[model samples]
Target chain A: MKGSANRRVLPGYGLSLGYTIFYLCVIVLIPLAGIFIKTAGMGWADFWHTIWNARVIAAYKVSFLTALAAAGINAVFGLLVAWVLVRYKFPGKSFIDSLVDLPFALPTAVAGVSLTALYAQNGWIGSKLEPLGIKVAYTPLGITIALVFIGLPFVVRTVQPVLQDLEKDTEEAAVMLGAYRFRTFRKIVLPEIAPALLTGFALAFARGIGEYGSVVFISGNMPMKTEIAPLLIMTKLEQYEYAGATAIALVMLVISFIALLIINLLQARMNKRTISA
Target chain B: MAGAVTAHLSEEASVRPQHINESVLVRIVLITIALAFLTLVVIFPLLTVFIEGLKKGWDVYTASLRDADALSALKLTLIVSLIAVPLNTFFGIMAAWAITKFKFRGRNVLITLIDLPFAVSPVISGLIFVLMFGAQGFYGPWLDDHNIQIIFALPGIVLATVFVTFPFVARELIPLMESQGVQEEEAAVVLGAKGLKLFWLVTLPNIKWGLLYGIILCNARAMGEFGAVSVVSGHIRGETNTLPLHIEILYNEYQFSASFAVSSLLVLLAVLTLAVKKFVEWRGSKWQSK
Candidate 1:
């Protein structure tokens, strides 16, 4: 394969390719395979029973619903934030724009602690909210808040570039042709950026589902109430229920992959439609 | 005639199309809503970290930093990142080189496989390691006989960090190198540049900024990683605890000031990461325009 007569133009092709495959096998593939192999050892009835318990079912509901709500909230507000950053020039605009990535850079535990501090019953914002009878920390609402915090940047970052690429003249022309501001945005601008928005939503939802470090602090971690799927998996592992943990992880992984695949397909379709139109 | 013409011109001015911006009142409302959301979600939590860290006093904050456990946790984080970042950097460069420089079968499939870790939960990233090396794991008995520990130790932490951060560099480099094309490398090869010399002279300098950006993000995540590390670390005070884990210990014990102090160190790193990231983006855009 390395003979000079049949050699490719790029040098080190064999060496680099071999190292990549070998490294990937050790680093990624083999370990993931371990999950399947371990789960295979369990009886189908046991696996189903482990994953389908009432407490686990409630956890799945909380995880999916909170993640969905958070991602939906982000999809709407993230667009507004991205649009504001791109289109409007204001005092401290650059500062706020850079601040959007704070959640990405901050350690999740730190985020968890700080958010828990801020929204706890006697804490600053929490004290005020307590009077209004709106509890944030240690509730399902608190879990959603933490999810929203971590998921914000996904939507904003994904949509910002697309929004920037949208030609200003198109929006202007729509308005000039008697379209109202709302109509112009809905008909002209939204369709152009909808795919990016959907991609962002999927990314955020996937992230929220798997989120552990941040939510554990704010969620209060009561099994039937605030316990998330990842934390439940952690609990099972702590009890050395390896098979049970793997069963739950398998379900989460499959769901996330399927959701992401559907989103990718939708995005591809949207891109095709836009290009043709 | 002049008065009539002026009146018509005034009418045209009144009927002129609105700019992309909404009415001033509406724009104010939109901007305010957006800014308020950011302030609530991002800025407030950041401020809380510092304020709570200093809530006790300067001396208490200093005491937390000087605590033996905090110092050791910091050292372990540094060690873990030092190992993980360089190893991943090398892997990323190799993977990117293979994918970008060659036309191959199953290329897209390989790329997707490389990205599998990104889609995985951090908890699962750690769980897989436990499955691979835990007492009941595949090699667990063999390892137990040899007295070699991977789980509940530094090696486990490093492996988990590497798994979570596997794609950062390659993801950054693939698109960049793809856009850069292979003309330069092909030219170098034709001119008799071979092997390491070719990469050293031609490729490294070309992808330097992207590589640096990738390394910066990788290092930050490696140091700050919590969920995966937490699962495998066993939280042995100063033994396996990274900074984030240490913060969790302190916070759980209700040592609020101490936890915040340890957290302040990570906050500094986060700030530094963002600053360098911004610089890299600026430089990258400038280079592209050239």
Candidate 2:
């Protein structure tokens, strides 16, 4: 069985592999390379200036901070949601479970408009909050709301399978050993599902950072305040500053890739640990 | 006598400790919080879409859908998805087949590269294409010399869509096909089956559900794509606007009813996608268990 390492039994390997590489290059690789190439064409100083400009810096702060905030919120709430779905059998459970994927399915623009409508000053949720002098729409808080909505499914879906697979006996055994319920959950259950939760947090954070459509309408696009990095890139492009846009995009791309790589490594380690434990 | 009574009680409790789960009060609290969160984040916006669409009455809602620009936007969205979905499906199948069926180095790297689109911002997804094909881009001179346009046109829209949705199908199939392995296909080959015959008669049936699952997700994303398409579409009314872009345009113009009306169509599509996805998952699980 080990001797056939260099040979394959299947036909069309050449053709299929060729087509795959070619299509990937055309549709994905070549265009991504274009970003680096274009950014490289700009002088180092110019590139740095474009990316580190005060306005761009503000946008970065707003984007990263809100994304982090939103991902943090989703981690706690999404865990509770997944836990409830897995542990409890309640009426409308299936309906609630189905709705978790709504963000994935709904068009972001639709989400943006509807959320904005619902949270605007005179709108359903906003009017109630406005009387308390707490603005939601047209603020950073609004951007976080949109990101949380879009990022909810990532956390829930990632954690759901892991929760379902968690053995009940370990929990029961923990109780039998004189461990309290909270201790059992913290020591036994949390360790098993921690990796999935981290992965979901990373995904949601990555998505929230790059999110455009849903945040755009709600954020009000104020230059120094509510503007997101993606919207800034869009603004640069609309301004016909291609080099500037590419520079900002390249920065975001590199950051997201690094974040994903770290998350992947962490998840692999967690899996190995769980297997050994 | 008291010790004897205590021992008996302890034995009974040890024999059947109540299930290691939340108390009824705790369960009720958790469920309430989860449902409240879902209602706020998911259900309310959905309700708003329909409510606002009908705010001006049924006639206005119907009229908006029949608007000429709305009709054109719908057509453009359909056309883009129609083109983007098939191309991606073909690529997905080919890529998955190659990776799963062959033993090769750098395979992991290739898979990572395939997922590049997912990690990239949608705005950047559009920007990359513009950098490659925009007026000041590398191919700009060549395209202009040949009197062809891509940026700010239909082709650009389709390419951006393809980029955003590039990973959906391949990502779905790779894990599935990897699990299925090539033993069955090898057996088929030993029986003299080859090429399209092998794929159609053997592999297709085996992975049909997974493939369908991939296509459903890919189609949904293709139709719902907004940020990337918006960048390249030039916002040319009735020409470059897809349904999402159209919604943005109408919303910006304060045509609330019309925006929500067109949005209702997309909402319907989203619901349909969810329903089909549920059905597919159910069917896929049934097959897998078999």
Candidate 3:
């Protein structure tokens, strides 16, 4: 098959193709498949029991909901940041734009420790917000905050180039045709960029769901309260409950895979609609 | 008018006069939220260490930087990164080359697989290695019989890092390579260059800056890797500890200034990367135009 398509593309079809497949097999498929096999030994009853326990169920809720909330936050603010960077030329714009990737490049442990310090009692803004009866540290909110932190750059970076290349004339025409600002945005601008935005959201959501390093310090790890799924998995591993840990991880993997698949399908549908319209 | 909008673009346009009052209100609200979010998420906590470090004087701050564990951790970081980064760079470049320069069986699947590390959490990355290489893992007994140590050691840290940071260089390289056409490389081939000579004389020149940019980003992430390292590494103080782990140890033991001092060093590296990115972008514009 590649040999046939080789006429259309580059030479050396065999070498690069072989290398790509071999590399993927080694790096990704082997380990992930190993995980599936590892969990296969639990049998149906144990698998269900392991994933549905009181602690596990509670962790599922906190982890999933906080990740959703964080992804939602990133989707909105990320779009705003990307829009600002693309449409405006303010002082320090470049600095802020570059600053977006700080989370991406920064070590997660450092981020975890730093976030804890900043939001803990007696810390700078934590102290200020504490009087308002809002606890930002060692709470579910802190988990969401860290999620938003690491997830922001995904949305920004994913959406920015699309925003940049989006034609201004289309928006101008919408405004001239008696569309209100919000209407112009709703009908014209949003449709064009919605796919990228959704991609950003999905990426962040998947990422937030699996996150550990940034949330560990901030979560307070109180069982039935702030304990996240990944942390719970780590806790299980720490306790030498390897099967139970992998079982929980298998639950996350299956659910995340299904959810992300739906998102990708939605993204593809959106892209198709955009192309047709 | 379109002209007016273009002129406004030059002027860093504020909300137009029609939206002025409302947007000023909106702007204030937005800025407050953005600044507050930044404060809570990034600025304040990061600033705390610096302020706390300086609370004592410059002399103590200087003294803190010279601590043996701190220096050794830094040395280990440089050592591991110095080897690990270049090796990963080679992997990333070859991987990227395989990705972009060919279309083969399961190409889309391969692309998705390459992206697996990014989607998988750092914690999982660590655990996978522990599952693969630890004493209880598959290869564990064999490795032990061979008198080879992998886990809870430097090799484990590097392997975990290579796995975690594997995608970065490839991720950066692929997009740039895709956007960049094969015309130049074809031109080099047309000029009778082959193999390494072709890559060196033709392709490498075009993608050199791109490859460099990816390597630098990869290096930064590899240098600061923590979550995965924390898992596999037993944190043997001076032995398996990297800088970030070292900082965590210091902070845990209440060595505030020393911890801050070491963390500040990591921050400096990050700042340097950010600065280099600026320079790289400045240099890239002309090439991008090609």
Off by over 4 Å in 1: A1-7, A270-277, B1-18
Per-residue alpha-carbon lDDT of candidate 3 for residues B1-290, written as tens digits (9 for 90 to 100): 00000000122233333421124455455555655555555666567667766767888788878877777888888888887788667766777767666554666566666766776667677777777778877788999999988889888888788777776677767766766656666656557766667666666777777677678878888899887788888888778899988878887787767777777787777777766666667667765456
B-chain TM-score, every candidate? Answer: 0.92, 0.92, 0.86
User: In model 3 chain B, which range of ten residues has the least summed lDDT?
Assistant: B1-10
Q: Would you list the C-alpha lDDT of every candidate in the order shown? A: 0.86, 0.87, 0.73
TM-score per model over all chains: 0.94, 0.95, 0.89
TM-score of chain A of 1: 0.94
Per-residue CA lDDT of model 1 for A1-277, tens digit only, reads 1123323679778888899999999999999999899899999999999999999999999999999999999999999998887766668876786788878888899999999999999888999999899999999999999999988888888778677766677888887798888888899989889988888888889889999889999999999999999999999999999999999999998987887676567667766865786
* lDDT tens digits by residue: candidate 3, A1-277: 1123343244445665566567556655676675677788779998899899899999989999999999999999888777666654456766676777677667676677777777888776688899999998889999999899878877877777666666656766766677776677678778888888888888888888988877887889999999999988888878877778788877787776765676567666866865676
How far residue B134's Cα lies from its native spot in candidate 3, in Å, is: 1.6
Write candidate 2's Cα lDDT for B1-290 as tens digits: 00000000011111223568877798899999998998999999999999999999999999999999999999999999999999999999999999998988888788888877878888999998898888998999999999999999999999999999998888888877887878888889999998999999999998887788688878888988999999999999889999999999999999999999999998998898777677766776677569
Which runs in model 2 stand beyond 4 Å of their true positions? A1-7, A274-277, B1-17
Clashing pairs in 2: none
lDDT of 1 at B41: 88
Q: How close is candidate 1 to the true structure, as a TM-score?
A: 0.94
* Candidates, DockQ: 0.48, 0.54, 0.36
